[model samples]
Target chain A: DAPLFDRVAFIGIGLIGSSLARAVAHHNLARSTVCTAKDPEHLEVAHGLKLTTDTAPTIAEAVRDADLVVVCVPVGAYAEVAEQLKGNLKPGVILSDVGSTKTSTVRDLAPILPEGAHLVPGHPIAGTEHSGPAAGFAELFIDRWCILTPPPGTDPAAVEKVAALWRAIGSWIEVMEPEHHDKVLGITSHLPHLIAYTIVGTATDLEEDLKQEVIKFSASGFRDFTRIAASDPVMWRDVFLNNREAVLEIMQRFTEDLTALQRAIRRGEAETLEALFTRTRAIRRAIIDAKQA
Target chain B: DAPLFDRVAFIGIGLIGSSLARAVAHHNLARSTVCTAKDPEHLEVAHGLKLTTDTAPTIAEAVRDADLVVVCVPVGAYAEVAEQLKGNLKPGVILSDVGSTKTSTVRDLAPILPEGAHLVPGHPIAGTEHSGPAAGFAELFIDRWCILTPPPGTDPAAVEKVAALWRAIGSWIEVMEPEHHDKVLGITSHLPHLIAYTIVGTATDLEEDLKQEVIKFSASGFRDFTRIAASDPVMWRDVFLNNREAVLEIMQRFTEDLTALQRAIRRGEAETLEALFTRTRAIRRAIIDAKQA
Candidate 1:
């Protein structure tokens, strides 16, 4: 059978980038896959792992003849990378990204897209705490959600092709507006990461001996936060920076809720605490029922 | 291969209570074990699961003729249960508990203990989100820590007997002052659970459509918090209420740290965010090195 695309170009070769590359290779979704990264070491490691069919030193060279160009770098770098690819994209090429924040995707890349090029921003809601090109695998997207936020007026064929590629790679797809996607993920992913980072950072500031004991006894709960907080710093920094309003909005709600619980604790309002705790358990049940647990 | 105790009495038969009964039966730690709970259904489930040698309708009856008694109910119920055990405890009996808050355990339980009956409060740092008697297994305590916080002037022999039972069941033992245990666990367990409940509660307050979407995309990061927040409500309520001083102290630190991160995000201080995230990763590595990851 003919492949989905003549060639697919990846603009970054880190965990998400390399994982998609592996999935494309495993399913033969594209005739050829090429990747480029600003970091020379990342390109070297991706080549060593054979993550892509070819490697390029620049985004312009990588997307030269490709029909699909997926920008998989951190959201903060989207503007700079888009500048490099402004007029070099092939005619009728589809431009997509695997960035966490979709609003920023359209904000930064949409302006630089050449004539006839379509943009379909996506977020594969899957990953481990590990990073780098060597930390990726073909099965990372299995049974996971691939949310695409293609702007209005985007070519339907372009959206369908991106959906098909993700479907072939083991992802379930949902399409929504970029603004709504950012808000939903702000609660589900970005805020959770921020809270984890904050809590773990709080523990990191504990006195020396107490800090050692915290690590030894982390299985109680702190260990889980540690895993989430250990995710790629550069990527998360970009996520918080680009998705500022949504994150701050959700964070405001979280802080308000936390303060309420703290006040309940202070006033010895056991009923209030128990009621809130029990109410939250229903969400967990709902998540389990949704098979997201 | 004689049993370690003539008879053992459990004041409650929830997750922790039933698991301890199963472990005692597995290791022949006691010749016979009896349990009683306020909820009749819990007693029925414990009996059906064969978790205890006998099920009593009341705490007073359960502790009759038993040489060792372990209170395993929520911390909020400690005072009420202690009232039932008072004046009924056998002379020279060793009394202990599996509650999460040690200072409260000592505070609530010490006053009711009869002369010649020794108190050795312990907190087994192990559990799952699931509760109830049927949710227990004999191996739940394997390779976990069981911390004993015996009050000053507690009988050394009584503490040793309790330590021996835990050792036979494959737990590493640590003895510390009750205040110290509360402070350590406030950071490691209580604060984490509070933060999780807060985050999950924030999601719960969202609009219905967005709430459903949060569940669908939970695998990103929110799922872990859901699991933590799903833990027994009454138990956590008591933990926060009874350990208010320690919990509030640690939560203050956490809130301050979180606010700092929030400001950094608002200001687009990528270096500050990245530095904090990088420092937290070292703690994860330390946890892994300690084999607690």
Candidate 2:
């Protein structure tokens, strides 16, 4: 079968970027793939791992003749990278991303897209606490979700091509508005990561002995939070910053709920505590039924 | 070789209780085991599963001639269970438990302990979200910690026997002051559960459509919290009520830390967010080093 694209370009070879590149290469989705990283070390690692057919030192050089361009750096670096690609992209190239925050992606990349290019912003709801080029794998997106939030009026062929690539890589695709994507993920992904980071950070402030004991006895439950909190710091910082409004709004609700729970604990409201705990189990069941657990 | 104890009695047969019963049988840790539960349905399930060699109709009947009595109910029920055990306990019997809060275990069971009887409170740092006899396995405690918080001046031989049984069943043992155990676990276990329950509960309040979306996309991070939050509600309710002081204090610290992070996010203080996130990663590394992760 013919390759899906003549040349696919990756702007940053980090965890998500490298994983997608590996999937494309492993599945023969692209005839040729080239990746460039802001960190030369990452590009070197990519070379050593043969993560792509080629490595470019600069974003412009990488995307020069590419049929599909994937921006894969931290979300905060989007504007700078977009600046370099302003006039370097192929005329009809499909510009997509594997970013966490969809709104920021569209805002930063859309303005620089050439007249004939297409912008199909995507967020693959898959990752691990581990990061960098070495941490990615071809199976990272298997059976997971990939959400595409193309701004209205985007070419159907362009969006379908992006979806087809993700589907070939073992992802279920869902397309929604960029704003709605941020809101849902704000609660599901952003809030959980923020809380995990906060609780683990709190433990960091504990007395040295107590802190060590917390780690020693962490299996009970805290270990889960520590794992989540250990996710890429710069990536997460960009997520919180770029999705600030939605994150803050959802966080407000979380704080209010937490305060209520804290009060219930204080007043010895056993029934209230049990009711909430029991109710939440239904959500777990739903996730299990959805095969998302 | 002879079993570790002549007769071992369990006062409840939930997840932890049934697991211990299975472990006891699997390892020949006890010659004969009998279990009783406040809920007849649980006793019936225990009977159906053959969780113990014998199933007793009441606490008194269960502990009448047992050499070791392990209370395996929620902390809130300790006072009532202790009342039933006050005079019926075999003379010189070693009374232990697998409760979460050690201070409450000591507080509730200490007074009822006969002069010659030993009070050796234990808290096995192991469990899962599932509850009841069907959810237990003999290997649940393997590689897990079993903490013994026997009050000062207790019989050394009794404590050693308890430790020996846990070791035989594949657990590492640690002895600490009850207060210290409660404080450490408050941060490690109790606070984490509370936060998980709170966040999952927060999701439950979202609109029905959005709520379904949250569950569908939960693998991003919320799924871990849901699994933790799905743990037996009555058990966790009792945990929070019994370990009020320690849980509340740690929760206070957690809330303050969360508030600071919230302000940082609101103000776009990317460095502060990244710094805290990076620090928490060290704890995860420490846990991995300790083989607790």
CAPRI tier for the interface of model 2: high
> Which runs of model 2 end up more than 4 angstroms from their true locations?
none
Candidate 2 clash pair list:
none
> How do all models score by TM-score?
0.98, 0.99
The residue pairs that clash in candidate 1, if any, are: none
lDDT, candidate 2, A40-126, per-residue tens: 987899999999999999998999989999989899999999899999999899999989999999999999998989999999999
What tens digits encode model 2's per-residue C-alpha lDDT throughout B1-293? 98889999999888899999999999888889999988788789899999999999999999999999999998999999988998999988999999999989999999998879999889888899999888999899999999999999998999999999999999999999999999999999999999999999999999999998998899899999999999999899999999899998999999999999999999999899889989999999999999889
lDDT of 1 by residue, A5-76 (tens): 999999998889999999999999999999999989878988999998999998999999999999999899
Model 1 TM-score on a 0 to 1 scale: 0.98
lDDT (0-100) at residue A193 of candidate 1?
Answer: 98
**Per-residue lDDT of model 1, residues B1-293, tens digit only:** 88999999999988899999999999988888999989898788888888889999999999988999999999999989989998889988999999999999999999988988899999998899999898888898888899999999998999999999999998989999999999999999999999999999999988998999999999999999999999999999989988899999999999999899999999989999989989999999999997777
Candidate 1 stretches greater than 4 Å from native? none
Best candidate according to DockQ: 2
